[model samples]
Target: MKNSTCLQPSLATTVALPVIYSFLFPAGLFGNILAAWIFSKQAPTKRTQYVYLSNLVTANLLICSTMPLLATYFARGHQWTYQSVVCRIANNFGTLIMHVSMYVTIVILCSIALSQYATLKKNSDAKHSPAANENFHRCVLNKFRQPEFAKYLCIVIWLTVFCITVAAIIRNNILANAVGEFHTCYSISIEAGKFTSMLAASLATACFFVSFMTVLLSYYCLNRHLSKIQKNTCIGEKHLIYGTVKRNILVIQIILTVCFLPYNIFSPFFYVLLPGNDCKKSNYLVEIKNFLNCLAAAKSSLDPVIYLLLDKTFKRSLYGLFTKSIPEHHKGKADIFTEETPDI
Candidate 1:
């Protein structure tokens, strides 16, 4: 993504990114660590969900780990010599890992949506629902509901993403363009390759869209199916299940919209605009791309909070850490969306 002989430090590179990354690093790190600890304490019945969530936490931690190096390079990479090892690790490897982690999270989010939908659909009363719909749901999403299957699925996702990212890195660095001296660290964005960079960006954007649409569809079906049950039931707080599921779905929806959507929306355009552009346009594109990337990284920071709010075990564990008192009324609350009607 080199545009000229040397890039001058802009406010985006020097101030905005460093400040943003500094905030993201510690916040994301602490949040994900807490999430990991809570997940480890989950009961064996939650093994399926633990598989999905554990992988998600791992990805978030990976994203946070890269932030410091990225921030440091942006803050003062220019002062360092061009041959410094920090430059390669910060711009090249850091960016690659971040991309891989982002994609892993995206895929896992989609899996969560499908998994929850299947669980709900299977548990829904069969008399009111079409038999074919239940059969279809079981046929498609039931396998993913198993803990062993989910573990394998996550492993495959990681390996696939890792391979794709490594291939792109090799192609971009070794095949697309010769290694050029970068006088300013700010200009050392993870792009120097031409076609391969575009391919990587396009693939990520495509993956995001597919996952986003899948999540939206899952939410729509769950809402449509569960709303009926909520309406007909004059019994206990069955609505609690509906509410919890609805809120969790809403949280993920918001997270996806806020953190992942915008970056993916505009990233493909950067590669297209990179070629044959003047220095001014190139710099602007780089700034905009990097800024959007920062927003995407914020997903890691936000996911921990999402888990804390929507995941009951995480919330309880966090609460217990601060205080030992447990309320009598809260002693036997039912699992979210699992028990449609508590044995009242």
Candidate 2:
């Protein structure tokens, strides 16, 4: 976003953003490195979740890596003093990391939801058919049960995000108009046309809702199925499974709400609320957007803590590292969403 006099961030916001980014940089760097190391210890091919989680850790690291440049930008009175190319790279990378991390987290939630759905289906089939080993059920069970599937999914996601990000970078740089002595990189300037603003707003709205709806649907389906299972049969591991699913749902809910929801909801408006159209409104919206983006960036710093809290293996490893105690050697497949097999 361009630094226009018509929509300058408040003095407080300028100072606050740098301070927040500075804190996030070191904290996110250390935490994500630890997370990546722990995730890498498990072979991704062996545990499909390890692939998604490993990519998520890397994505967060990328987000964190952009903090220094951002902190500099903010500290320099919210202006870009660097080369245009460097500024573009830093700006584009920050957005890219955010989108990639969000989609990867969505994929993780999908993986968990699909696994639970398959189990529910298999149970339903078992009740109906005396022969629980039916081919149909087996096929359904194995649908998304492959590590290769997850790898391919991640590859596709990365490629798509790369294309979208590159397009955004090109559009922003091409459309930018200098507001003053300092050239603004992505100006919704009076000189620039409305095409870029329209395109960006449309894209932002679509991306936000798609991811939001997916998470909501996944949570709803899992909760409904779990409720049915509990009512039908209160068996061993029932409470444990319910507890795990609920925790996963709540964590994802909080992460998305904090990181993506507010930024996405208001970003389109920020783009369209141009300086020429309404100076006061534009300035207010710009500051609000800046604050929301800062909150979104904080997700990178928070994700490692989320993993430590939610993933048993990660928690144990972290504990052992701090306490200087020998950690238990985990055996077999690490289940991310099951208490029985504790790993992420």
Candidate 3:
């Protein structure tokens, strides 16, 4: 039988993670911070997309916040020198941040779907009364679309994620106590740890499918609505709207798959679920898990880049930061989000 020690990841095998972290930590820090700064400079608008985008930037900031500890962990060759409690907190906080990012992205896509529906209603029913149109607008964009709603939603998400993080931290600390080690944390080793890891993986798998479907449904609805308008509108205008919406949709899909899917799908396999010991294979599996873990971290940084590409307001704010003097007319908050992107 292969020796159990051989199953432990070697320095060579572990090298990739710290290298990834080296880049992710700096990039995520710069990008997320810039995103937050840009969002801060803008005033809250009546547009529902502004609320959703704000929440997304907040989530991205949380996700990026975990990188310093992670970079240090990998820098030290997989042995966490921090206290066991700190280790547990860091790991679980990372989990909390990831879930927040996932849920916010789902909400953003769903809102886009809702916007598409509203546009269809307005376009198809030209004879609709002014009162009826106002009612429709309020229903679609103002019921729970206010900055106040976003504030409450974030509070609820933070509370829920906090509970889960605490539970995870407790479990890890309990296991660390049982093993007579109070300086390191492992995701899977004993029966309890394996069980917990599997449970988390199951949850992540469910989220993956749900979010993917939500994005697809949003894209389909938006495309259908755009198609209906193509006949009446100028060809150039129709194609521009269609192309921009499609581009944004594609960005959403790429980020969702690239960041979350690997960790969700392969995390379960990292545990030795079968009866027999296979240390060599197990080690390889764990290495893959770590690699995916780094990829997941990359999303926090990439999200800000997405915002820069897709959000005209955010792009202007970002551009304003570097330029010493913006024209007096361009500096106002109201001017930032007024660029028309058709129905998007």
lDDT digits (tens) for residues 103-141 of candidate 1: 999999888777766666666654455566567657787
**Number of the candidate with higher lDDT, 1 or 3:** 1
Off by over 4 Å in 3: 1-7, 43-46, 77-148, 175-187, 190-192, 231-239, 268-276, 324-344
> Against the true structure, whose TM-score is highest?
1
* Between candidates 2 and 3, the TM-score winner: 2
Off by over 4 Å in 2: 1-4, 42-45, 77-86, 93-142, 177-182, 185-194, 197-201, 275-277, 322-344
Q: How many residue pairs clash in each candidate?
A: 1, 0, 0
RMSD of each: 2.9, 4.8, 5.1
Q: List pairs with backbone clashes in candidate 3.
A: none
The estimated TM-scores of all candidates read 0.89, 0.80, 0.75
**Highest-scoring model, lDDT:** 1
Segments in model 1 whose C-alpha atoms lie over 4 Å from true places: 1-6, 43-46, 79-83, 176-189, 227-236, 335-344
Clashing pairs in 2: none
Q: Considering lDDT, where higher is better, how would the candidates rank from best to worst?
A: 1, 2, 3
Per-residue alpha-carbon lDDT of model 3 for 1-344, expressed as tens digits? 32223345566445666667667777877887887777767735655556656666777676667666665554442354335555655565555565556545555544544443344334333533336556765464444444566556656755654565446556755765676553334323421243554565566566567767776766776567566556555546446545655666666767767776777677555543433466566656666766776776687778777777666667667766788555565444222122243432
